[model samples]
Target: MITVVLPTRDSAARLVHVLPLLVPAAVDGLVKAVVFADAGSTDATLAIAEDSGARVVQAAGDAGARLSAGCAAARSAWILALGEDLVLPDAWRTPVEAHLAGGGGKPAFIAAPGPLGLAGRPLAVLASGEAVTAAGGFKAGGDPLKALLGRLRPRAVRLRI
Candidate 1:
C-alpha cells in the first residue's frame, strides 16, 4: 500500500480533479491513506480535504518541508508524493504496483505528459518509506524534491498516458 502526500496552497480546485482519480486505487487497497500538507491555504482546501477523509497537516517552510510533514504522517510503507495539479494517468497503478512488488529501494518518478515531461518539471515521486527516511526528509531550500530525486538516483516509471 502507498500513502499519497499532496502539498497544497489554495489547491482546492486542483484537488477536485486529482482526488477522484485515486478512488479506484484506494478502494482496491493500493492506497491506504492521503495526507494533505497545507501551507496555510486561505481557500476551501482544508475543508474539502477533511470532507474527503484526508488527514490535514499544517506545513510551514518550503515545498520540501511540506512534503516531509506529509510523508511523516503516512501510515503505508510506500509514499507517493505528487503535485496537486498533476493528475495521474489511468494506468499509473501498473508501474506503481510493479515498483512495490519488486522491492522498492531506490525511488522512482513518473514521467509527466506533454512537453513538461520528467525532464521539464517535477512530477510524482514514488519511494519506499525507508528511502524517504534515509534522505532525512527533503531539504529546506532550493529544489529539494529534485535534490532528493538526484540523490536517490531513481529509476523512471514510465506511464503510457
Candidate 2:
C-alpha cells in the first residue's frame, strides 16, 4: 500500500496537470492516495484538488509549517513527497516502483534527474542523492517529477546523440 502524499501551495496550474497521472487507487489491495495540502491558496487550488478526489488540507501560516502539516496527514508507509509541478510519465511509474521495492537495502532515495525546462526545451540535470535539508525547498527547481521523468524519457533532454 503506497500512499502518495502530494503537497501544494497556491499550485492550481501544477496540480491541474498532475492529478491525472496517478493511477490504480488501490492496486492489488494497496491504496495509493494523493493528499494535497493547500496553505491558504487564494486561487482555485483547493477547488481543483477537491474535484480530483484528492484529500485537501488548508493549513494556516508559514510554507514549511504547512508542509509539515501535510506530512502529518500522510497515510502511506512510503510517502513520496512530490511537488505540484511534477508528473511521472505513463511508462516510468511501474519501473520506478519496482526499483524502490528492490532497493536492496541501499539508500531508498533514488533520483533519476530532470530537465530544467518543460518536457522539451533544452535543459537537463543528471544526479543522485537527496538535496533537501531540514527546511523546505519546494520552489528550488527541486522537483522529483523532473528526476523521475528525466530517466523515464531521457531522449527528451536532446543532448544530440
Best by lDDT: 1
> Candidate 2 on 44-143: residue-level lDDT in tens?
8878777777787776644344444555676655445554444434444554456446543222232334476323421212111232221222222344
TM-score of each: 0.86, 0.57
Q: What overall lDDT goes with each candidate model?
A: 0.78, 0.47
Give per-residue CA lDDT, model 1, range 5-96, as digits (tens). 98888988888888898888899999999999999999999998889899999998777888888998999988998854645666778877
Cα deviation at 160, candidate 1, in Å, is 6.1
Candidate 1 residue pairs that clash: none
Q: Which stretches of candidate 2 lie over 4 Å from their true place?
A: 24-31, 61-63, 87-90, 104-161
lDDT at position 77, candidate 1 = 86
Clashes of 2: 2
| Pairs with steric clashes in candidate 2 | 113-147, 114-146
> Residue 56: error of model 2 in Å?
1.6
